[model samples]
Target: MDGLAGIVREAGRAGDRVGYFAALYRQVTVEVRTAVHGGLFDDGARMDRFDTHFGNRYFDAYDAWRRDQSGPRCWREAFGLLDDPDTIIVQHLILGVNAHINLDLAIAAARTSPGEAIHALRRDFLLINDILARVVVTMQDSVDALSPFMSLLDRVGARTDERILDFSVRQSREEAWYNAVLLAGQNEEEREATIQRLDIRAAVLARLIARPGSLVRPALELIRSTENDDVPAVINHLDNAMERSSAKQGTA
Candidate 1:
């Protein structure tokens, strides 16, 4: 949790500062491992191995002096979350969009079409969505953790605390930027863009849920019912389906 906390702290830094998140990513894996015990992990031996492997891959990359050379490529994908709040919000919206894709992929795979080999492509898309969702949650948590600071800045006297005011102003700007892009409702252009995004998501969901496997059984069952009419239930059902799939597949 320390590492995770560290990452969140770093993300709250001034917007002008780059590489803050990359540094945080380098450290977060360590904290994540520390948070997991033998009960949460596979076992002592397997956990040890996981710790070592993750350390080498993630830590080494995080430590790299050059973004292209030394750091883990995964961090590069995540760093944008810190740079812009709008991107952070987009990340969450994309999850809902991707869930739509998962549903579409599942249906598509079940259809048994023979035009082209979409199975692999759809699978890849679903996997990417799953991965990105985790990243989005991390970013969301980081930003949420900073909300108190935002409120604090609003109260501080600008004349007496110029430096703090400057910091507050920057944070306000960053947060506003993120909210405008992410939390704001969709305009026609944005909605149209989202529809295109939905197509890709649908393709992936169709591929994954096409089969009546245990991994997606819950989701498939829910879809078969009228429960998807409730947005919260749909999200919960999807989250449950993914969790079950991860447990079955031995994913950490």
Candidate 2:
């Protein structure tokens, strides 16, 4: 009912809890929508199609995974955690990112251009990454803004640590690109198998995020304890931060 947890929580109650990531994802589609209408990408039309097609796959999976209809292992693991009481906001974000980037992203890229056409897709592919990266940095800031403990978390270094920042999204994305390259050359059947393997591998990551060790668990608890819990406020702050970041880079 509340917008604080974003659309994801509402989806859970609706039996499609994947809405947890869907909320953030819906925000991404808006950003991509703007880019499409404004011709922000190199091959604007093609990228727009790619973005839309890619986003829809995730949305479909959200429903399927929710109902036990069928989906990737990584996504299943991520969705299963939506109602988890011990899961912190960052962990929820991480679970979504882990499934999307480590798993979904590679699949999207491969499916976008099978075989040699994949090479042609690379430039535009990275272009989309550029757009997402800027939003990501600001989303990082938004978390610190919406969550009380993030202020203290920010003091750890001259800057906030990357792990806590995007929860290693930056690092994971780099590997995703490499994995995508491999997927591009595979056949559909092979790609399907590969997806399952990646999902299995990604499931381990979701586990660590949800059930981290003692040292990390305490810090995760602090952030959850201090979180605002106002879903609309949190989403608004995140959207505003995304817009500001976009403007700074002239992407808006």
Candidate 3:
């Protein structure tokens, strides 16, 4: 079985997290289709609708969707297929990291001078746009996986409800940071705003894990293992959040 560290690195390669996410989006979508068409073990029929280059069919679909509909709704509907809790958590992190890439591209476009850098930024923006569309589709597939389990859980009483709540909180904070950076200038104000937005969630998660007799060390170690980058900091925060949630679970 793949561990979280491997998963994080796999999702962050080639200095282009968006590309990593695009690959993951396709993989997860295939997995969902396999699960839906046959059992989880069967090789499902594949759909190559969004399999074009970063700018061709993929970007076209993304532009049409952006013009025709809302942004977050598309993702909420996309990954809603996956029924497994661990997969859903993984999807959340994937989506969050992908969102960060889009925001990063937007910031670069907003700040740089017109030249080769501008051309590169434009190219990057289109790629990011395609990635966003793919992520939405992938997220919808995950939602499908979660649907069947949701009803059973509702009937079976609260099971890991706190963990779900914690995930939601972290997802929101990640989204907020993405928005702040994407919409604002690349100046100090923008950095401060994004860092502040992320800080709130980090503080909450730290407190949650710092409770009496919590399993904070392993998670902290995991966070520390992540290489020095923006992605690593976010992973560290989530690790802490998970640690806190686990501690709370143990006490309960």
Winning model by TM-score: 2
lDDT of 1: 0.33
- Candidate 3 lowest-lDDT run of ten: 42-51
- Cα lDDT of all candidates, in order? 0.33, 0.68, 0.36
The CA lDDT at 2 in model 3 is: 27
| Candidate 3 off by > 4 Å | 1-134, 142-186, 198-252
Task: Compute the lDDT for candidate 2.
Answer: 0.68
RMSD per model, one decimal: 20.3, 4.4, 16.9
Could you tell me which 10 consecutive residues in candidate 2 have the lowest summed lDDT? 1-10
Q: What does the lDDT read for residue 85 in candidate 3?
A: 26
39 Cα displacement, candidate 1 (Å): 2.9
lDDT at 169 for candidate 2? 73
Candidate 3 scores a C-alpha RMSD against the true structure in Å of: 16.9
Instruction: Give the top-scoring candidate (lDDT).
Output: 2
Stretch of 10 with least lDDT, candidate 1? 158-167
lDDT of 3 by residue, 1-252 (tens): 123244445444433232223444344334334443454222112112112221132233334544764333223222232222222333344444333332332333334322233333333334334434444444433332334443344456643323432333234433533443344444677655654444444334333322212343343333333323344333333323423444666999
RMSD of 1: 20.3
Q: Once superposed on the true structure, which residue ranges of model 1 sit more than 4 Å away at CA?
A: 1-4, 13-42, 65-74, 77-86, 90-252
